[model samples]
Target: MEKYPLKDFMDASEPIIVEDVLAHPRVSEIAHTLIASGLRSFAMVPIAVGERWFGVIALGRNEPSTLTREFIRSHRTLAGQAATALESMRLLENTRRRAEREQLTSEITARIRETLDVETVLKTAVHEIGHRLGLAALDVRLGVDKDLLTAQSETKIVEREKEQ
Candidate 1:
């Protein structure tokens, strides 16, 4: 498989047109395998957009000399169209996911602002986030320290006394 003629074309990003699979020097090693698969001639066109190659469009013929130049040209066109369609679909999907994420953020922010209570805010945030992401379970932990709170409270008291 590593030494197969198709692998070379895939790496080279070049179209392969073998008129006779068995007699072709490049495909002689894999001729038996091709014959077993009932292929006398084969062609592969790279489905690529610029330097980004998605894959290959392969066609096999039972009779040699059947894969003509015109046929390969048509196959190349098909491969290009396939690549464009696939790239467009990928871009559309990405845009959809980004829109969903932005909508989820807006919803969570609105719900959080509707309440002043810390517990309500936390619960609303967690629930909205978990539900939006389709999570089985979600948890939030607050690591508030007693010492830190006491120090902060004392500082506030001192500031208030100074202001008064």
Candidate 2:
């Protein structure tokens, strides 16, 4: 008896197959393990998006059944909906990241714009960004080829933010 279908459908959200166990070995093997078993048919659709492989939407039945073109078409349609949700999430994440980066850059720029000395800029940026992010460590990567200026932390300690 098979432990399960070749794959388990996660969040497939609907009953989509019908079959019998003793006749269809593939379905029986997987279903036999369950008490209300004897499923013999199977259907699955690959939830693929671009080059990324996500998952599958699957259904099983207890009689002889074939994964037909119609089932595949329906499965892929649901998979496409899942793909759309994924795309929306990805876009939202990207938007949030970009906005955060811009805000950080703006804060850093505003603090340093008036200061001619690189030392003050570095010190001010470290204090502002560190507190904003509640970061444990913040370091500026200095590269000479990129015309990046050196910004070193001052010897004086910056008092930690007050307890909320």
Candidate 3:
């Protein structure tokens, strides 16, 4: 029943079935609603990606004893497919982010090598890195070994030490 505590069922990695929701001790609050809806049985199968549980797939029917061994086996197959799909999507997202980061690094390095003007190189680096990383702001230090260190941002530049 809807009022039944899900913690007990969800904690297990195996499939669980409640053949008669109205007869369950924890479903007293929602027994009336369950009867009204003609829901007699329900089953839940946990979906996990790697070692963590992502969610559950629930099956409900009007028959009092619908969730049998065969039904549970079928639900397990479905749950496995769902977990595989989720893992594939996660891998794809991670691959995309890594590719983007690599491209950003290469572009910045190329730009720096192509320019000898320190101001132009710094500005290009800030703009390219910010747009690639989707950042609101960033700061880069220039002349780290010199007495005068300058910090550059997308909008402005500040000198941190006395100018040479």
Best by lDDT: 3
- lDDT digits (tens) for residues 1-164 of candidate 1: 35445676464346888889877898888889899999998888888777766778878888897666787788888888898998898889999999988998998999999999765676677777777887766666443543111112111121111211
- lDDT of candidate 2 over 1-164, digit per residue (tens): 02335544323333334344455444454565632654456565556566554666656665576666776677778888887788788889999999998998897889888797655766788767776777766665344454544433433343323232
TM-scores for every candidate against the unseen true structure:
0.74, 0.58, 0.70
**Whole-model lDDT per candidate:** 0.72, 0.60, 0.73
Question: TM-score winner among the candidates?
Answer: 1
C-alpha root-mean-square deviation, each candidate: 8.5, 8.6, 4.3
* List of clashing residue pairs for candidate 1: none
> What is the lDDT for 45 in model 1?
87
Clashing pairs in model 3, backbone N/Cα/C closer than 3 A:
none
Best of the two (2, 3) by lDDT: 3
Candidate 1 lDDT score relative to the true structure = 0.72
What lDDT score goes with residue 83 in model 3? 83
Question: How well does model 3 score by local distance difference test?
Answer: 0.73
Order by lDDT, highest first = 3, 1, 2
Report the lDDT of model 2 for residue 115.
93
